[model samples]
Target: MFKAGRTAAPRTRPTSMKIAMIIAGTVIFLLLGLPLIVQIITAFRGPFLPFGVSSAQWGVTNFITLWELREDFWGVLGATGAFVGGSTVLSLLMAFGLAWITVRTDAPVRRLISVLVIVPYIIPPIVKAQAYLLMLSPESGVLNQLLRLLPFTGDVPIDPYSFGSLIFIQSLTNVTFPFLMMVPILTNMDGSLEESARVSGASWPKTLRRVTLPMLWPGLLGVTVLTFILGLGSLEVPLLFGQESGKNIFSLKLWTLISSSSGQLPQYGLAAAWGLVFLVITTIAFAVYLRATRNAERRASVSGKGFRPSTMRMGGWKIPSMILVTIFILLTAILPLLALLWGAITPYPVAFSFDAMLNRTSFAAFGTVLADPDFWVALGRTVVIAGGSATLAVVVATVFAYGIARSRKTPWVKAADLFASSSVAIPATIAGFAMFLTFMVLNPYIPLAGTLIALIIAYSYRVSIAYRSSYSATLQIRPELEEAALVSGASQLTGFRRVVGPLLMPTVMAVWIQMFILGTNEFTLPAFLAVPETRPLSMYIYAMINPRSAQLYAPDQGAAMALIFTLMVFAIGYGLQWLLARRAIGRARKAVAAPDLTPLSAAPGGGGEDPSATVTIAVAKRRARARVR
Candidate 1:
């Protein structure tokens, strides 16, 4: 009789496979890290040619020049601080309100409200900026026009291009982010804390202040830091709205140093210097973020028992609260969208009036955009680069995650993870600049700058950072399933393909779609790396709205292109969501039909002596059952 309890010899991966994994990890680390190395070297080099071409003579002149040119540096810093600080605070407040209403209260139409809140985020920031500009431009804003129609209203109520307006626009664009972050924390928090407070004779308000707020402090702080970092690095909003109002933030200042010729050579060294400054700021912020999250995780108080938090009854306030949320959605998403639609049709920005609507409304802008051959080229390039980069990033990240998960004992895998994660602290503009320097310095042999390939590389690098974190989590959770496959006479590749692959498909697809959305809207990377022939739609839109581009500046045409792009993004997002939903349903059905074959217990002196033996026995029994069938 066969001894079913006998332990088998330990399995090891092939030597060639181990070598290949090491090689891949090294390549990933180098690719992700090379840009920073280039930036550091470029920052210290002396300016010799136009656009700060490196002289190879190392010195502190760049830093000194940056200091001497600091006439308005303090002012720019003040503006940046105000923009980042105000946007963070306001965004947090708005997010808190939305999260509380939706998660804590018996708010009307919670599902609709949640969807509306996320809609603005789905709309690209470039498009949102254009919409806001149309609605808030001082002389011809549609909102201003509506106000003028009111009694005794003469001038525009508010200028869209002011510092305060910058904060407002940034807050509106970012509110959904913190709201998304907070909702899950609010949903998952142990309800017992709040229940105990209420039971101790505390009023709802007191309970919230003492119990709920304290529990949420970590998430709140983490989101605050994240939002502040995002706000600080924001380029499009400041470039579009702040520039006209003479508000110079650090990002815009850095852009000007790199892009503006101003009848003089571009200050590449100074730009690099500025990039270093921003890098330091981002690094410090990231450190703080890490600490806050660690502390929050330590303080987490989830209980094993499943209990739902009680929702507050809105009572007489229900209808009014719903109205307020509806209004918020209208202002945040609908109004901007309507503004874009109006601008797309009109010949120029105009107030809402019957005459303007009837005569000025036409598809001339779209016709112009579509008629141009360059538009088609740009559109094709955008789709290919965005889709390709997202796909490539996901594939590479998945491989890296798998390698790291399986080879946690290997030093190279740890190094790869560290290098990839560090890229998160690098700001987008700085990353773009770093790519620019890397390509420029090596272009003689490699010839990558000013090409679509370079843009793809930049976008892939940027996205892989997020994918690494996502894939790492999913990989960690399912190692035992893969081990079970291995125990049942499956090779590593076969096991991953048959077992882990199926489980990871949904997560992989979600990451791919999100990365695609982000890639399509990417501005800074393409802005620095793209040449005229290789320009993507994002660059096209930027040119149309750019005040300095006299020949290319066409607000109506830009709005038309933005609207088209926005619709495309939404279509892709919705399509993917539907597909994933159906896939999930199919999986659920299959799971229901399948018999449960999980191991009941471990037998003595068996391979079941190991922790993973249960999974192995379950898988083996399932295989035996399948053969019998």
Candidate 2:
């Protein structure tokens, strides 16, 4: 097959292109990462207000402030660690077992189970808190109400506000995440890699321990880091579900600083300092995770193999295990909606019965909202602010992702990737608080002190990682199609519009919708950045949650609000999925003009199809081809 040909040396690109890329990357990093850096710096703002953005104030004042209430502060931090650890361990076990069952087994009803598992994750956190409250409220809880009706054991309420309940709810709500993470890796893994270990007489547990565990350790590390950071930075579930009864996470302690009645004027500096401390813990975790996974590489275990994945092969564990998992799902996802609908229809101090089902469907739950101008103002503000911010973030992310994927030949691409992904390590709370501090100072320049601009920047930076990941995949499609149009006399912009833009529309739309849902469901950032004039729904819900307000049934009001929020999220998700399907059909119809090259196998040794044979020639050829490569 050798032919006489002269190969020319590769052409070199101009140095200016690389220089331009480097500058772009540096600028992007500075923009996203500067706030965290500033938080660390501003902690030294020296026992004073206005924590000036100067090196002079960059001392240890804030860190010391944390220890001033040494016992309480440290105790809360301990509680934070406990919450993170318990939740992490539980989520890991749940995810691992569920992933194994769904991926490896012929678990009956697997499809429905998989979908239901993710449903709770989509439920708003406040909604979850409300449902738990209804069933576990100290005195008039549904559980207590039921106990009273029983002939025996009627003396007490279940009281699920302890550290135990906090762990239970946080862990249960997060199990869906690890399950989602494992699916892709499990699917892409080669069956053969596991087979080799099995053939060498490894028992199932041994195989998992020595072979699969080692290989999946990187993923485990990544997931664990994410879970730990999430819990450490958490505020909602613990704040609402935990009692002063032996559990107080750092986030709660920070809340005490803000909302504790005795404080003179809001001490932004101390709260910011606490936020900075939380950021420090997460930063250390991120650094450790980066180090641990630094050398981890993808290992493919199977190619063409006769080995079918082993099914769950449940001997006696089926029914009991099903009962356990079902109970959890029922409580977390199913009960929440039922409870929400019930509370929305019922008045405050609700007593329960099957007869309550016969009560009139009240528009009153929504009626309260109708009379309140703030409700529509908040809803309209949510649409205009959150919706617009999410869209802009996606656009910026798309451009940023394109710069990295297609234009990485420029020096700035590395910087863009680092900044975009680095946002993942910075929780929304820290970013929001950082911006809160930064805005207070920068307000002089842009008058951003109380506007949506501050919140928008915080939200965009926080959600940029999702946008970058989604857009990066779309950008990796071949550029030759666009280049051909340009060469055919189309302008550069026209070529992108005609070629690249159409292909990216699916991901662009998806990122927009997903970010919108994430933004709306988000509570913590809005708590910090959203104010009375431009408040979001989460903050509105927060006001209702406080017992001091005229509205004592805060849980019911929030549950009603949350139910509406959840429907809005699903509407967006379903709408995007439908749009994506339609786009695919349209593209397929238009592809009739393109030639089909089915006769030629593309990849080397991609061998012909096997019409028959338990042991096919195609497998041999494919294996041989892979080995050669």
Alpha-carbon deviation at 19 in model 2, angstroms: 12
**Residue 380, candidate 2: C-alpha displacement in angstroms:** 2.1
Candidate 1 residue runs with Cα over 4 Å from true position: 1-17, 48-54, 149-154, 201-206, 244-247, 315-320, 409-416, 464-477, 484-494, 590-617, 620-629
**How do the predictions measure up, each by TM-score?**
0.87, 0.82
lDDT value, residue 446 of candidate 1: 86
List, residue by residue over 1-629, the lDDT tens digit for candidate 1: 88689698899757543554566556456556777777777678756322234445787778887788677666766777888888889899889888889988888778878988999888877777778888777876766776777888668687787788888888888898899989998888777778888889999889988888888888877787778876776677887887765356877887777775567667777778778877888888878777767767665777667666767788998888778787789778888888888888988777777888888799899989878787778889988898888877776666666766776557765666666667667767777887887888778878887888888888887655545655566655546565666666666666655666666788888888788888888876777789888988888898898877789999889989999889888998889889988999998797556655333434334543674565445554465333323
- For model 1, the run of ten residues with the poorest summed lDDT: 597-606
lDDT of 2 by residue, 1-629 (tens): 97879988999755443444455455445447767665655566744444443534556766677788798677877887788789988987888777776676666887888888889777766666767666666564565676677786656635577787788777877788778988666655555567788899988789888888887787788888887766665667766777475346766666555553555655566777877777777878888888888877644444465544545466577777678778767767876677677676766656666575567446476667556677667767666666776776666565556556766455555655655777767766677677766776676676887687666666766546554665576566656554556556565445544555666777787777777777776777776667777777767776766665565335556667767767866776678778878987887686443343222224234346444431333333332333223
Best by lDDT: 1
User: Each model's C-alpha lDDT?
Assistant: 0.76, 0.67
